[model samples]
Target chain A: MIGVFRQWLAGLPAYLWGGWGAIASLLLLLAGWEFASQWLDPLALPDPRTVLATLHGLLTEGEAWAELAITGRRALTGFALSLGVGSALGMLAGLSMTASMMARPWVTVLVGTPPIGWLVLAMLWFGASDGTPVFTVFVACFPPIFIGAMQGVRTLDGQLREMAQAFALPPLQRLFDLYLPHVLSYLFPAWITALGVSWKVVVMAELLATADGVGAALAVTRSQLDTAGTLAWIVAVVGALLAVEYLLLEPVKREVERWRTLA
Target chain B: MAHIGVTAPALELAGVGHAYGARTVLSGIDLHLPAGRIHALVGPSGCGKTTLLHLVAGLLPLQDGAIRNGFARSACMFQQPRLLPWKSALDNIALGLKARGVPRAARHAQARDQARRFGLDDTALGQYPQQLSGGMQSRVALARALVLAPDLLLLDEAFSALDVGLKAELYRQLLAEQARRPMAVLMITHDLMEAVRLAHAVWVMAPEPGRIATHFRFDDAPAQRSDAQVYARTAGLLDDATVRASFGLDAPAPAAPLALAAVGGLRC
Candidate 1:
């Protein structure tokens, strides 16, 4: 674990340097928003300054962190549950052709069902508690992770499997040394996608089925005609998602896949 | 341990037959490999030389007859390197030892030693398989098989992909390793000269119900044989009717007028 942390730490400078393009694109987006604000009514799309000021006010005085914390908890909880179950089941299913074949339509159903449709069912089932958002996030995030793991298993080279057998690798070595490393490549990308899905779905679920969260704050701002406040909530959630993805997950991914992406 | 000198543990296959559903690939196969000996199986493609090797390596199930593997441990190198792309070359070299539950530091030390002998430098050992050149990857694969000190080493066309110079260098390393440690080797190849140079015994296989057509044994140790001797022996073996038939080659035309042929000339 310490070695992993060291590698992650050693790799951080390059990783941060690679973020210049993303920072520039974000700057461009801010400029575009500022330009658009000159023509549109402030009621519809407030300029970047107004949004940033409102977001600052919410951070200092309003209960923004508490609501966001509640939403983050629900999103992460649901995402963790699905990550475990989906990856486990997907690997198991991938090992057998019959199982994966049978699982195809089920994955399709999960992926195809709109989160709004599930949110209504969740509202009916869990009422106004955290269950509605958490369950909805899980349902929304499961398919990508599952399919990623399944493909990872199925696409393993037959030659490598033969090599493993010829060398007499133990079951644990086969799992850790051979299987896990290969699966992580596919699993990591799907995890990022699933995390994005979980965040988006939880917020949507909160807006319709609950009375608190960034989504609820947005709803409150909408009712009060506070367009800047609504955008501020959006920026907070988006900014949080970007921070988690870039600062945390991306660094970990780079360290793990150093063997794959050597310069 | 069994009596030390009492019949040095050998692999004996008797009447081994294998079929994939309706199609039979191998039938009535018999072979032997005593300790510290090298046997090469030679034939055209699709001749089930690989199938027989896989059977000995326990990579495939036997459908008929019996194989008695007396070696305590064995390792295999395939036509391709087959190193784990995610693993550093050092880890790949240490894979067999790792599978045997040797501690990491010990295996890494041993692998590093063997890898250096195989012409891999420290940087190459630390790199992943994809990052290494083809020749370096092959060296790592060879080192991986040898690091375990296996009683039997299986090579399925392992060195066939290398350039002539690299092949000669590796052949020296392999023979030196074998001379020092005294382990058995079973290799597959299409090149007859390779068989003549490396193997103590060469078995030719014919496809379509694959079976051993004939076998020849050389008296001198492989390392002592000269290149001219290898060429002469390979040509001598190729002249045999059964060996030519196994390879699906037609008989030479009526003897032409004798002419003084230069060096490296076709025997035909």
Candidate 2:
């Protein structure tokens, strides 16, 4: 078993190094938090152990998981809707100069408007319903994805287009086989950015507009003066964000770009 | 091996002239390519050789004259191997067939067979264009062109980027393919030796409203010509006062026969 473990470790030296470094940093941070907690009241700044225990209790009780699921669903719904609509519009803008000119003002307005302002407007429009959080997430995430798709289409290599024309490829074949792959290079990074913003915006909307999801739970913890529980909820949100990015987005990006060589 | 018809010339040009805005690039150009003949166009830079090829390939609209092509399909290989970076070598080769509405399985099978004939092994066929060497990329490009089974093949300095050994090998492969299935080839080159080595006839083009200055036809097959004979012919062509004046090489003929490198800059 030790021999097998050693071989496994040897096979992934880079991951091993990164994992050890992360563990060391986390331990150092926890120690600093522990030291700080000793100087303050337990209610003001809870120790790392207390926060860990609170997290463990929350996990076992299952309420935290339900809140997490609600938040995740809202964020994902908003993200999927925005990605589909934003990419379609972006492609239209990229292809037609008139469309691009018309879209510039709207995109600028959407990007400039703060998420809190949209959350307030959504609350006014949809009241206390789940639509508030979903709308907030979509508004916050759409701009980056739109801009990325537009730039991607605009910056495609001219030589490749010429080649396609010279070969007389049909329009649909060029779109699927040439344009899609090239556009993905720009679209992937925008997707990751949109996803992170979606999570944050969804929680903020939930905190203000509804008594559901992690944001609402954090509100309850704040009212009860349970600082450690609030910290635990924050940690859970971060963990979920990292999981989506690393597990889903990164693998797809690597697969799409596998044709590239360092040389 | 499939002949559409025997009587028609492969390609014909009459009074072809092109202008970019108000500036004329070519004028009064007349040329004809008979079936199964390899013709080379050699000229100084900025001559309309490439423009003429594009016109015949239907990439550019005719400005002055007319172009007639009897071939149902034509293929061109550019100076650079314009392979789609996202595609594997086999997929790049199959692209034209795919565009022509060939079924996926059959085109891929044909592409694989064509790849093997171009001296590309299975390993090379599976690689992306960037993953392969320059010579290998050229081979893929050539394979991509040939897979169409074109009746007219257009090459625009296609082998200029390759080293001598690779270029010679590709020349041999091209000649072998031509022998098996006869096709009219119109190649534009700055390399005189390459023109002599491959072309049955060579046309010398002059600039400033680019037009053919003269033409020379070789009676002997390209494979039968010796280096001495090639050099002698090259020297004879370079000796012409008009050819020298067009190239801006007005000096009296050098005591030593002109080497290929000496005339490299004169190529279009």
Candidate 3:
């Protein structure tokens, strides 16, 4: 664990250095936003400066973190549930031809049904509770995680399996060493996608069902014609997502993938 | 070989036959490898040399006969490197030890020692298999097999895919390992001269039930044999009617050398 941590820390400088291009691109986006805001009514679209100021006010006032936490808890609870169930079921289904074949059209159906449709159904089933948003996030996020795990299992090289058997790997070693490492490459991308999906779907669910959370706050700002407040909430949500991705996940990904990735 | 006591057992096969449903790939095969001798099974592709090897290695179910593999432990190397792409070279070479439940630090230390002997540097051991060159991958694969210190080692044309230089280097490494470790080796290869240069006994297989057609023995030690002797012995083996029939290389006497050259082992 210390070795992997050291490797990640050693590679941190280059990883951060690569972020300059990202910052430049984001700054260009702010410039575009500033230009486009010149003609629009403030209610329709706020300028970037106004949005930043509003976001700063929300942070200093200290209420934004509570609402963000509520929404994060719902999204992440659902995302965690889907990540576990989807990865497990998908791998089990992939082990057999009949199971996978039966699962394909079902996966297609789940992926096809929009998150709004699921939210409506969840609201009907679970009322105005947290279940509505949590269930919606899970349903919206299941297909990609499931498919990633299934494909990972299905695409494992037969020669490696044979090699493992010939070497007589213990069951635990077979699981942790041989299977887990191979599947992780596929699972990480799917998990990231599902996490994004989870966030978006949970917000949509909360906007319609919940009386709290950042989504409810956005709904409040919408009613009051407060475009800057709405944009601030959006910025807060997006910033949180970016922080989770870059700060937490990307470092772990680099640590696991350093074998194939160049130093 | 079959008459030995259980104390120092060698690999022995008796009347072993294998059939995939109705298609028989091997039949009536009796073979033996003394504890520390090297044996090569030489045959053309589709002659079931692989199936026979698999049966001995317990990779395939035995259908018609029995194999008594009394070696304490064994490991195999395939035509491909077969290293897990996600693993570092040290981890790959340590696979068998890991399976045997050796602790991480001990296995890694042993793997590092073996990798260094195979000419892999410390940086190479830290890197993954895909990051290395093909020859380097092959070395890692060989190191993976040898780190087990098995009494028997199986090679399924493990060197046939390499260029001549790489093949020669691996051959040297194999001989050097054998000098210190003294294990029985059973390798399958289509290259008749590789068999002649490396094996104490070479068994040729013919298709359609894949029975052994000829057995050739070399009295000279493989490490001491010169390139010229290998070539001359290969030429002499090619002239045998059974060897020609097994390889489908029946040619007029004057054109025999040309036919033998085209039989695919003489390239630099």
Report DockQ per prediction, comma-separated. 0.69, 0.43, 0.50
Give the clashing residue pairs of candidate 1, or none. Answer: none
- What's the TM-score of every candidate structure? 0.94, 0.87, 0.91
Q: Pick the candidate with the highest DockQ.
A: 1
Model 3 lDDT tens row, B1-268: 3476777678889888998889988999988888888999998899999999888888888987778888999999999999988888899999999999899999999999998888899999988888899999999999999999988999999999999999998999888888897799999999998998898888999988799987867756789888987887788777777888998887537654443333333321
- lDDT by residue (B123-168, candidate 1, tens digit) is 9888999998888888899999999998899999998989998899
* Best-to-worst lDDT order: 1, 3, 2
Q: What's the true lDDT of residue A40 in model 3? A: 92
Give all candidates' CA lDDT scores: 0.89, 0.85, 0.88
Candidate 3 has an lDDT of 0.88
Per-residue lDDT over A59-158 for candidate 3, one digit per residue giving the tens place of the 0 to 100 score:
9999899999999999999999999999999888877889999999999999999889999999999999999999999998899999998888888899
Q: Write the per-residue lDDT of candidate 1 for residues A133-210, one digit (tens) a residue.
A: 999999998999999999988888989999999998999999889887998899999999999999999889998888
Candidate 1 lDDT at B121 equals 89
| Fraction of native Cα contacts reproduced by each candidate | 0.85, 0.54, 0.72
Error of 2 at B219 (Å): 4.1
